[model samples]
Target: MTDQVNANSYLDTDSSNICEVLQILGAKWAFLVLNELLRGPQRFNQLQRNAAVIKTQSLTDTLRHLEQNGLVLREVFPTVPVTVEYSLTEKGSDFQTALKEMNKWVEKWGKPQQVNGKTSISS
Candidate 1:
């Protein structure tokens, strides 16, 4: 085999790390949740309200998944009734650059169209 490595070698399907990251990010609300967390730490209720469309169970599941993946940090504070907040870990914050690039790409090429009353991109 040639010594030169393909630039996209890490994107191969067999790359477990890449696959895992994709799986985590491919979840329905992952992007939105990450976008929200990029701002700052937030409580469960705040995230739920900001996300607008996610159900309680779905948000919980998403947060748990993010936490399990080392992308989100969950902190519990001692208070009258106890308080919990979620924020991005270093690894998660590192993903911001990728998200910014993705935003750039969308702005460059995404064509918004009406699809069943929902806004979708046209190829």
Candidate 2:
């Protein structure tokens, strides 16, 4: 039998430390939420609307995850009725720089393509 070659063996896993970073940011709606916040702080509803591509449930989960990760801060305004808004924390701002670099990489190197019109990417 012929030897089977593995394509991934050629890659240096350590060089892709950013993979973990991207994984966190790659969660559904996470990037979009960050992109929205880049514009400025916004209410929950605004985020939901801005990240319309993500399901409402997914967006909710993404926001909670980001908040838990200390990348996003949730604020409550004391008024007759409480108003909630989300803004990026210092950590999140630092992450934005990474994301910007990632964006530049994408612009220079073509984005991953869809195979057979399928919407997902496989390892």
* Candidate that scores best on lDDT: 1
TM-scores of all models? 0.79, 0.70
Clash totals for all models, in order?
Answer: 0, 0
Worst 10 residues of 2 by lDDT: 1-10
Q: When superposed on Cα atoms, how far off is each prediction in RMSD?
A: 4.2, 7.9
Which portions of model 2 show Cα errors greater than 4 Å?
1-23, 111-123
User: What is the Cα-based TM-score of model 1?
Assistant: 0.79
Q: Model 2: per-residue lDDT, tens digit, 19-67? A: 8676677776787888888888999888888877888789789989899
Best by TM-score: 1
Residue-level lDDT of model 1, residues 7-121, one tens digit each, is 3564564587777778989877888899999999999999999999999999999999999988999999999899999999999999899898988888778999999999887
Error of 2 at 56 (Å): 1.9
In model 1, which residue pairs have backbone atoms overlapping below 3 Å?
Answer: none
lDDT of each: 0.89, 0.79
